[model samples]
Target: MDSLEQLNQRLREGVRCDGDYPPVPGEGNPNSPVVLIGHSPSGTDAQTGRPYSGPAGELLDELLAEAGVKREELYITNLVKCWTWREENGLRVNRTPSAKEIKEWVPAWLKPELELIRPKAIVCMGGPTAQHFLGKDFKITLQGGQWLELPEDSPYLKLTGHRLDPKPFVMGVVQPNYLTHLQEHAPETYPAARANLVADLLKIKRVLEGKLPKPKAPKQEELDIPF
Candidate 1:
């Protein structure tokens, strides 16, 4: 098996999809017990050549600090390695990746990286990422922060074509970028979103440290309440 470094190098030199920016590799310790997955890189990330290093990145750092987790202690990556974009008024505007683009990249890039890192817990930030791993019908508004176990025959595992020695615990959280926008434009929703992000990260920390209890399904009432 190629090492994580080797696989990352391969990805760096790989071809980018049409209308996509170059791939941005995950950062932080490969041996970290937790992994954070986001939807994709933004224009800032594409320019910085780093995942989560823009305004959204700042929000993430703040949330992680509030949760008592360090940015350097968790492996951070995106669902899609490349930046999906469109030219808008002579400037490249970041756009959400299509399902086809996501499907193509996972097996080719993200899956291999996961196989090598083998994190104990995974926090999927944003709807697309959560849906990608959890299933097509996943609703982050209802399910954020709820712990879930990957089934033995999960489609995600099948898609990866890699067997994880110990299946990682998974949870969903709101995207930092969305939260930032909320903070600026929808002040009323910002506090709740920020609280939810911090709480979710704390849960991930507990899971990684083996302090969290066994997983259970969220109640209907719990699902009804937005996080």
Candidate 2:
């Protein structure tokens, strides 16, 4: 899209899975050097007409602040633009988006959005979101902290419309949503999970300060003709 407003407008004008709610577009500085992507929006996001709302959002703000990252300067979006929620126990809860939904929203909505933002860093907040760009086998526990270059041939480029040289640094992190999940279902692990998320964000902070460099892109090999 030519403008962030156009991008948001496209979503609002046509894109709809749950038409009952307004689409939540990526917000913050459209040209931000950093972008934080979540899997999907929560019910609160629908209500607020923004991404990252409710309890998870509160913790996300605290974590970003602790990590010296300002949400105001970073663009934030989701893998899916809409809130993928279903009624359960008389309350709404986020649900796993179907393959069709992922195909419809992610490649089309998130791709051009990233192109417009042209972020230097892309932080995929959850495992599924990470794997969508990274390989399906990516494991956050092992690779979450590492800053890897998005290869020129990366499907991410085609999927997310990232074409700049020395493509954006990609890092996976335990989502704040997961932290809330830990708090509710696995209380003992919440502290460590929270700590790790902060540590990852701190890396991003250092990257922005020119103190830490992301891994360089791989060089292409030359062909030799012995004839």
Winner by TM-score:
1
* Model 1 C-alpha lDDT versus the unseen true structure: 0.77
Candidate 2 regions off by >4 Å? 151-155, 158-166, 210-212, 216-227
lDDT of 2 by residue, 82-157 (tens): 8898799988888866667777787788887877777788888876777676765566766676777765555555
Q: Give the per-residue Cα lDDT of candidate 2 at 173.
A: 81
Please give the TM-score that candidate 2 achieves against the real structure: 0.86
Deviation in Å, model 2, residue 25 alpha carbon = 0.2
**TM, every model:** 0.88, 0.86
- CA shift of 184, model 2, Å: 2.7
State the lDDT of candidate 1 residue by residue for 4-113, as single tens digits: 88887888787664565677888888998788988788878887878988888998898899998889988999878888888999998878888788778888888888
